[model samples]
Target: MSDIATFARVKRPVVSTWRRRHPDFPAAVSANSGRPLFDGAQVTDWLIATGLGNAAPQELRSELALFGIIALRNRFTPWQLVETLGSLLCLRRLDGRPLADDGANASPTSPPDAEADEALWSALLRRAERIDAEDDFVLRELRAIDATAAPLARLAEDLVESAYDERGAYEWLLAARSRLGLDSLAADAVTPELRSLLTQLTDLGVRLERGESLTLADPHVRVGDLLAALLDDAEDRDRVTVLAADPDDRLTRITRRRFLLAGVSELDLDVQTGSDLEERFADPYLAGPDGPAPSSD
Candidate 1:
């Protein structure tokens, strides 16, 4: 009942009222130390059907229910879940198929099954190889969670379904980093104030259009927070070339996928996994009066 109240974004007393007044409310599925535990899915369904709670949107409900299950399972750490879900969402965007039909797509809408855990993992691994042939983004993360990949896949699918796209899903997960106990793992966290400043400084709306694109560089691309902020204002994301580098390999891979989901073509992205102190790319852009592109487009 408390879970239901949380799901509905209502008071605990309201949940009791619901149980007393609404005979159709889902019954307790089991007892957990004398407290009745109702099915999360059932409660979500009831809330959606009866139009009783703030969890009105189907996507929000999916997200909530998935989180509940993740908490119950307590198998993967917050970082593991975030990274693994990112790979699953990336696979879904690239493959255009349900993950479970093959292995670990979230399938929030389907009945739980355990048919193709091994096969699905293998297939997803192969797909990850093909998609990230260089082992840049999704490959290592997928392999890390390979032993129990199926459950993670299902959660990933729910994420995508909730956000209605891979980019939104991945970003949503990242936004919940602090909530997911990932503050320790996360780097250069983008607070609202800093994000606002970054976005204001990165006002590329006109430049992105005038030059047909821009090559935005972030030396500290931990999870691509700053770059993603710039990309958000870009009118032509595909044309924009991103040049970034980070010392952290894992964070770099995450930034790579974040860029991919932002609509920057893989061919156009020039992100690396080390500092660019030596200037690798040819004739690097210099900021000065004598520098090229006086318009700064």
Candidate 2:
């Protein structure tokens, strides 16, 4: 954590230029203890000012949702808001533009235009998946909000946005269905063609986990989605414990926690609530070796 002085030394110019135009920038970024509170508006402003882009995925999702709410109020299409946010985030990530230039990049010899959109979309999807994979503050906020009802639906869409690739799209659908009570219409949202697309994406994840080549064309459902959906069915509910073989290993990796839930009965529907699973993930103590393991997830 760099002191305010240090941040000013490096980030001062960017902030200064931002303040010159905006004029109402906070005196200094608010912090508790020492870590700065990176709110959505500040983050978006920083990205726009520095041209650095939305590096923080969860935070970006929150910010984009805020943008969507404004759009909804203005009578703009919700889908259009999502597309715009996604495109902007993708472009920023690919360009790695600095905040100083007001986000204008004129270099023509950059990554080919054909490749830029794909790279951008891939970046946004990866960010969204990572947010889903890790239950962060934004995730909790999204879960607390109603997806199919009221003001939160737009936020839910933003959280579940960035389904650029088939796998990402599939995972998001299942996530929405499980968390947002969109289950009845989930299958409808996921067409056969989309399933095929997701199948391929799932295959990629499996291959990566196995440290194998990722050339397969078969569509594979995401392991996370399958697990999440399985846990939601009442019959599939089972008592299982999560054990991390290495106590000191990093918990950030998607593969490290390898959850092993124990309720796979042949004829029973193992059901569990999405919130229950989420609660288990949110527990920091559960990351410790000696903590009592939750039998669900």
Candidate 3:
């Protein structure tokens, strides 16, 4: 924390204040004798993107473009490294390809640092474009961070390796929603006890249905956290289908990724964005043009 204060040219308490007040602050990665140690890269990304520190605009400027430092010097950006890396995990899951060829094939957790930053970024983005040709999940985010791709890509790799799978990685990333300033998505991010209660209620509902399938729907699904938490560790994932929608396009895409990576088949998931609804293109179950017959989530 003191180190962060020193780098940001702020008093020690200011850093603490940022941590306490800002839900999107990068969390401490570990602790040394009780002093929390944060990931320097994540901190740097946060400061640069948020324009929080005393660092100048030029110092934080990305190679592609300036991140709105001059006019909105202290402006907070909605873009978070966690969000970008979350998309990358979705891309990797979609492709089933390692984001890097440098020992990633041999080891899922330990990505090599042999390649240059530019080369590694290019290679990973090529893979991203190949998988997400429609720019649905990752292409935009990956391309936007050319300057910080080196650290962020390594971070993404570390996330996948440590979490064991794409679904786990995504859940872990979303767990940092407060730090990433996406607290709005966590409207139902309740206490563990409450989450357990919700799961129990859902289980009871399923039981009342006599082993029938469930069609859970959220009209404004934000990254699918509420639904995902309810369905976590449930044995009926295969039998459960989800119909989710959100006014935010990015959130809808991320929600779709969250469920898809959590073993929800494409046919079992239907997520519509704001535009989809504006055009009346969303069918509830996607069974036909009329959705489910007198049924919906």
Top-scoring candidate (TM-score): 1
lDDT (Cα, tens digit) per residue for candidate 1, span 1-297: 776776688889999998999999999988989999877767777888888977657555555735653573366787787788887777777766767666454453354455556677788888888877867678888877764557667677676667778888788778777767777645567667876876676567765566655566666667878778777877687667777778887788778888888888877776788765223443323211222332242
Ranking by lDDT: 1, 3, 2
Query: Candidates' TM-scores?
Result: 0.82, 0.24, 0.60
Expressed as tens digits, the lDDT of each residue in 1-297 for candidate 3 is 987786677899999999999999998889999999876557777898888978653333221011111111233244555556677777778878766663233222234454566677777777888887887667877777663345455455655665667787677666656645656765646578866866775573454346666666666566776677766846567777777777787788778778888878777777788633321333333232223442443
Off by over 4 Å in 1: 56-59, 103-115, 185-187, 277-297
Deviating ranges (above 4 Å) for candidate 2: 1-73, 98-210, 216-297
- Tens digits of per-residue lDDT, candidate 2, 1-297, equal 232112233354554465567555544546788755434445455554554432444444443444434435343343333333233232223234321123113221123343443343344434434544443112322233221212222233343343332223224333333233334334534345544654453443433344432111101212223333322222222332222222111211111111222222212211222212222222221222233452322
Which number leads on lDDT? 1
- Judge candidate 2 against the unseen true structure and give its global Cα lDDT, from 0 to 1: 0.32
* CA shift of 230, model 3, Å: 2.3
Model-by-model lDDT, in order? 0.70, 0.32, 0.63
lDDT of 3 at 152: 53
Better of 2 and 3 by TM-score: 3
